[model samples]
Target chain A: MKRTLRKARLLLGVTYAEMMEYRAELYLWALSGIMPFILMGLWAKAAGETPMGMPPVDFVRYFLAVFVVRQMTMVWVVWDFEYDVVNGQLSPRLLHPLNPVWRYVASHVGERFSRIPFVTALMGIFFLLYPKAWWVPAPGTLALAILAMLVAFIMRFVMQYAFAMLAFWTERANAIEDLWFTLYLFLSGYIAPLEMFPPAVREATLYTPFPYLVYVPAKLLAGQPVPALTTGFLVTLAWGLVFLALQQVLWRTGLRRYSAMGA
Target chain B: MHGEHYVPEPMPSLNGSRYAVAWRRFWLSSLAAEAEYRLNFILATTNSLLALAGSIFGLHLFFRTGYRLGGWSWEEALLVMGVFTLLDGFASALLNPNLNRIVSHIRDGTMDFILLKPMDSQFWVSARHFSLWGVPNVLFGLITLGYAGKKLGFGWTEWAQGSLPVALAVLILYSLWFALAATSVWFVKIYNVTFVLRSFLEAGRFPISAFPQPSRFFFTFILPVAFLTTVPAESMLGRTGAGNVAWAGVTAILLLLLSRWFWRFSLRFYTSASS
Candidate 1:
């Protein structure tokens, strides 16, 4: 266990150093995630005129929480994995004592670390612009929201990694991820809050893994009432397990295919 | 010998017809190369359709609550959405496939080859690739525009007048993308800058007036996103004054010139990959 911990420390340290070298690119990526803010403007406007069960300020806070949670939970494993697999770069990595997945995990964590200052700065500017929408959550709520964000990140990573395993069979595996992302963008509460969804649509989407990704953590952070907090966590866990199992199976099968290709 | 001077002969400029031929050859070769990926075509079409459906559904959510987006009726907002999709299609088809390669060319020193050519470097880079993936979005966007136009009782004259702004919107979008892509010379790792621009341009999916005062101002004067889809939709609906159209034309021409100037300026900083 000590040895494993030391290895993880080295990996994360190295990746974090690599990430810091591209600070400007990282800032641009953080700025690219301003979609939630744009939607916040639109939703806040709509909610002002119509009774959408939430006030304009609530919409503001909700989307602010969303932007934060999304930044924490973003995943792009499919693109990287596809590149490595297609270019035969995975051959060298397969010789490592460690599972290759750990590298991706460490890199993502390092990027998250690198992003903290920029994300905080953006949030500062946002609150300065709309100070009325600012409020601190209770300590307990903040703790739970942080936990939820971590789990949501894990679930998203596992799902995209599973999709990445398709690189074994296809060159354009990222295209599949693009399709999945389209669904995620709409149904994952990224575009609008679930409260604004039609009643039937909201009920239906709850059964999918989409809402638990963004809505649950965001609502918890925004201090909005999430009626079934335990249920949300359970569903997130369930989806994570499903994707984890799928990824393991694909990893074994894909490795066999990789070796068969004379790699 | 010290006092002797040599004068170089003037090279012939390639005119419009030569450029037309070159454009055709560039697209045909790219199309042939891309046609090998038949499955990709299907997947791309499906993805575009799904995205369009989701956008319409999202717009419908606001209308279902009896809130007209920026005081636009449902059909009018649909027009805006239609124009946004069309521009997105144009980007994906030409601008993305071509301009996204600028960073790689700069990184690999392949840009030296492009510059050595007799043709205009900007024209060559911007017209190089034509992907088939975006054709579906183009078709779907036109269908939506037609359907919405019919619902709004738009006549042929309105469509004709609207085409001018739509064309100008294309020019404005191309300039913005080219200028952003040219920044790769200074910041080779900043490939995602265009993505940042794209996210900001997402505001064009809605009518500009739908946003709050500050947001409207930002989209209008700062980014000029208001000229992209909203102005064209307004032209089609006959809600915009001739002055708005004139402003859009001016903005398009000025931005085009600015992008041309920016490209030349950026080239000064482009030390090829090795040098």
Candidate 2:
């Protein structure tokens, strides 16, 4: 574990330097999550007279919280993983003493950390433009949201990694990711808060991993009513375990198939 | 690369007289190349259809919560989305595929070779690599637009009146995209700006008035996404004013000239990799 942590530190440093080298690209990528801001405007306008049990101001705050929560939980490791698998880049990593997953985890975490300052600057500018949307959550709720966001990040990462492993079997793995992204955009508190969803759809979405990734965390941050913090944590943990197990099975089978194919 | 097959023929003059024929040959070559990847074509078509479904479902859910979004009825919003999909299809089919080539050329300094060619470099880089697979997206967009127009009782008169502004809107979009791509000359790492542009383009999926007060103008003038999708939809619905069409035309001309000037200016600073 100590060695793993040490390697993670080194990987994080290298990734930070590499990310800085393409600072313009990194900045644009960070800003690409602006969909929430756009949706916020649409919803806020629709809720001009309180359309879905929430007023326009409430929509503003909810989407602002959702934007920050999303930035914190965003993951794109599947694309990288797909590239590595297809290009035979994973073979060298497999020989490393440390697990290759840790390298990805470190890189993603590093990128997230690098984005903090940019988002902070953006939030500052955003608050200037719409100060009414800025409100402090309760201290306890803030802590809970942070924990939920960490869990959400892990769940998303593992789920994406499992999906990326499908690249070992199919060339159209990114297409599958694109499909998942479409679903997530609607179901994952992106288009609107989950509370705004019809009760039947809301109940069904709670059973899926999409809400845990964005909705639950944003809900926690907004200090809205939730399905109990413990319940969310447990559900997220269960999903993470399922995805990890899936990854293990796929990784083993994929590796064998990969070797057979002479990669 | 398949580009080797495109050998320049002997010409009488070097005043870019061969541009039309060259573009046609390149388009045919691209179509032939993409024909080899049958599965990729199928997947691309599936992705486009899936995207159309997602947009429809999202609009369904949005309208379910309220009768209208930002004063536009559900059908009007659908029309905006249809226009957006049509323009986005044009981007993928014509503009975006060449964007990747431009970035690589800038990065590896192969842009100099293209510049040395007798043909216009900007035209060459911008018009090359026609994505035949994305043609279905255009068809899909037209079908969606037709469906929405049918629901709204729109007829040929509305379309005929809207055609000029729509054509100008397309020109404005292409010029804006060219200016964005030309930034790679000075900023070699602007490849991901395409993603940013796509995000900005997504704002066109709805009426510009649907955005916040401050951003309505931002999308209208600064980025001009309003002209790209919203104005076209309004023209189709007969909601557009004569002044709006005039403004759209002026913006298209100014942006086209500005991009041309910028492309020429940036070429002076481009130091070739071979040098």
Candidate 3:
């Protein structure tokens, strides 16, 4: 186990370095991924005085927090999978000793490093854009927010990876992506708080993994301590494990149906 | 073989004489191609319908909770959404098919052929690609707009007063589409600029009044989403004030001239990616 973990770290580092080769393109990719900021402005306006139970500052605080969390959570695995699988670039990834998921995650997180400047600039812009948000997360909650971000990354990665893996069976992965994006728009608080959903929708969304991916961390960053940070973390961790297992099953299942054609 | 292979038969200067025929030929061929895959086309149309429904779902969720969106009555809001959808469908159906190809043309170097053409290249490129697929969305927007008109119960006079604003809205919409399409010069990786453009366009779905005043001022005056939806819709439903229609004409002219100048400027970068 120790040897595998060490090997995994080395492999991860190498794959990340490969992605850094496209550092300039990667930063633009991350900045371009952040369309949620525009939506956040609109929602913040609607929440004037009080937005769906969040006070005015909380509205500012929640969305700005969301801007950062959503940026961090976004993964472009669908585009990657479509480009590779549709174009027959999967053979090399398949031949690697490590799990293909690791290679994929490594490239993704490696690309995230290029995004640091953009994220910092975005936070600075948001602060300048809204100077009245008087609350800040405690150090402890900030720690939990960071942890939730990690869990959220792995969990959302698995979910998007699974969605992309469907390209093995169908060519319309982007159209499929559109459907999932529609769900994320409402369920994940990309547009509005999950709290603002009609009670039934909100209730159903909370019990699922979607909020853990974005909204939970947004809440934590906004200093709205969820009932237990531990609960959110454990839930995300559990979902991550479940998806990890499910991904293994999917990998085996999908590979059996796979036929190789050289690009 | 290299020089002569697949050479076109030169016909009488390739002038205006054959242009209309070529136009007819293009549409006829496209229609034939679309007819061959009727089922796929149907499914794609259904998906766009689903997307339109999703936008409606957003307005529904909001109005289910509140009566007015940014001082818009429910009826007026629907009309704004309807106008937004109409302008959007028109822009996508008409302009995008022609202009969206510019990025690929730049990347692949095929745009040189366009540059060599005698006619206005931008006009040729912008109008050449008719989206037969966009017909459904156009029909869908018309249906929604019709419904909203019925709900509003406006007579011919209102629509008469509304015509200038509507035309101005369409002009501004086209100009904005052209401006974004023009940005392909600086950014080769601009295949998705329209995606970001459309995301901002979604703001027009709700009244600008629905946002705070600062946001309202920016998206409306600067970004001019205000000209796209709220201005025209308000002309029909609310007061046909001097403020709305006057700015509509002025902004439309400014945007058109500026987009034309921008397109000309970007053309300098067109060293033709193709040999």
| Chain B only, TM-score of each candidate | 0.94, 0.93, 0.87
Better of 2 and 3 by TM-score: 2
Clashing pairs for predicted structure model 1, backbone only: none
Candidates 1 and 2 compared by lDDT, better number? 1
Ranking according to lDDT, highest score first: 1, 2, 3
For model 3, how does the per-residue alpha-carbon lDDT over B193-261 read when each residue is reduced to its tens digit?
A: 665666667778887788777777888767898888888888887575877789899999999999889
DockQ per candidate: 0.78, 0.56, 0.31
Q: TM-score of the B chain in model 3? A: 0.87
Judged by DockQ cut-offs, the docking class of candidate 2 is medium
Task: List the global CA lDDT of all models.
Answer: 0.91, 0.82, 0.74
Candidate 1 global lDDT: 0.91
Q: Summarize candidate 2's per-residue lDDT along A93-117 as a digit string, tens digits.
A: 8898877888888888888878888
Cα error, residue A131 of model 1, in Å, equals 1.2
> Per-residue lDDT for A200 in model 1?
99
Model 3 segments more than 4 A misplaced: A1-36, A49-52, A225-250, A260-263, B1-50, B60-67, B91-98, B130-136, B156-164, B189-192
A71: Cα error in model 3, Å? 0.6
> CA shift at A201, candidate 1, in angstroms?
0.7
Q: How accurate is candidate 3 locally (lDDT)?
A: 0.74
Off by over 4 Å in 2: A228-238, A259-263, B1-17
